[model samples]
Target: MSLPPITSIHNPKIQRVRALLGRRSEREEQSAYVVEGVRLLEEAAAAHLHPQLLLYTPDLAPRAQQLVHTFQKAGVECLPLAPALFASVAGTESPQGLLAVLPLPASQLPSQPNFVVIADNLRDPGNLGTLLRTSAAAGAQALLLSPGCADAFSPKVVRSAMGAHFRLPMWAAAWDEIAAWIHQHSLSVFLADANLGQPYWQVNLRPPLALVIGSEAEGPGPQSAALATGYLSIPMPGGVESLNAAVAAGILLFEVARQRAAA
Candidate 1:
């Protein structure tokens, strides 16, 4: 099939990409997102997530051209746009002139998973994404998202995740549903908080565990607060209030990985 030419800035597809970059509602309505730059598109393709449509500048990055050809042979809609038009739709100040509207993964978390990371409404994209990267590194089975967290698919979150969005099973749930799953799995729910309970290293994380991190500003929501079996803290010997949420989560997740490895 001949690839369709996107010659005009007013093209509906171009308009859609612009809207997706600017507004969350457009992404929600279309079940699409603006994944820009060569890195993201390359990783998405490596994960076998063929995009519904691959849009790039007429001049493609040399490293990305092979992947573009692969998509074309796979029958995905792959083509280029005007450099000026592509730049207007790209998110970053320095545009890579490459992007795609890939479908979201269909994998859901197991009803009672043995190992998991529960994000209890993390508000910061960078924090949430770092948690995801940490979880993947620590060999956690999946990432379970509770209410009030940033959209897992948002461009900021995706960029911060550093390829984790394609690597792990990520799912969303209500607090009650997550709570019920915790109880059903006999999983120990550990909440990481700045001021509370035992130091994180003292906690036994080898068993089926759902390690929960909370919002950056307010910490965990009331539902998560009430549901925590116990709270764990990391000592700040330097008189700091606390580490950033992602830093804290990375420390705690590695702790869990350490305990399991030792056991």
Candidate 2:
């Protein structure tokens, strides 16, 4: 089935896609987010997610064209846009000529979750995304983002995460909610602190544990800190005061993975 090309910027679908990509609130209200690039579109399909809308341009790569056809066969609404118009809303400097509007996955806690990561007030989207990727790689069952963290579904986050969003169960909630969930699940919580804490390797990172990583500027807030069963620190033998939030999280999460694997 052939669809009309959308050349006008004022087209409702174009406007909505732009809004979703630009604003977190809009994404929340619409229950949708935008994914771009051939790799992400392929990832979305591999994850068994159907896009509510798929947009492409004449310049779309052959691989992307085939994916578009696949979506079309699956009864997805696929449309074409003029290349210039498509680039206008694209997040990357070099547009890929393909994008999709996908429903936000439910933010439920994973069933039988064993390892989890809690991010507290992380403002950097790249950092948060990398953390998600690391957590997924380390076999974390879920992630919790405290208030003030960057929107997990933002374009930069989704891009940096490299499809972790589709695989990882994640939720954003307030401190009270996070604390409640932690206690209810009976999961031990460890806060990553640069100043004072047991070395990460020395800490037991068995299943049913949650690691809390804080913002770059400030460590975990007082409320979050108070909820911790213990604290962990990475040794800085090179005289470095601290590691980047994402790097620290990767190290801690993998340490947990290493222990679990050995056991």
Clashing residue pairs in all predictions, respectively, total 0, 0
Among all windows of ten consecutive residues in candidate 2, which has the lowest summed lDDT? 106-115
The worst-scoring run of ten residues by lDDT in candidate 1 lies at 1-10
lDDT scores in order? 0.82, 0.90
Cα deviation of 220 in candidate 2 (Å)? 1.0
**Tens-digit per-residue lDDT, 178-203, candidate 1:** 78878888888888889987998888
Instruction: List the pairs of residues colliding in candidate 1.
Output: none
lDDT of candidate 2 over 175-216, digit per residue (tens): 898898888888898999998788988877885888999987
Q: Output the lDDT of residue 90, model 2.
A: 86
Candidate 1 Cα misplacement greater than 4 A, ranges: 1-5
Candidate No. with top lDDT: 2
lDDT of 1: 0.82
Error of 2 at 199 (Å): 1.1
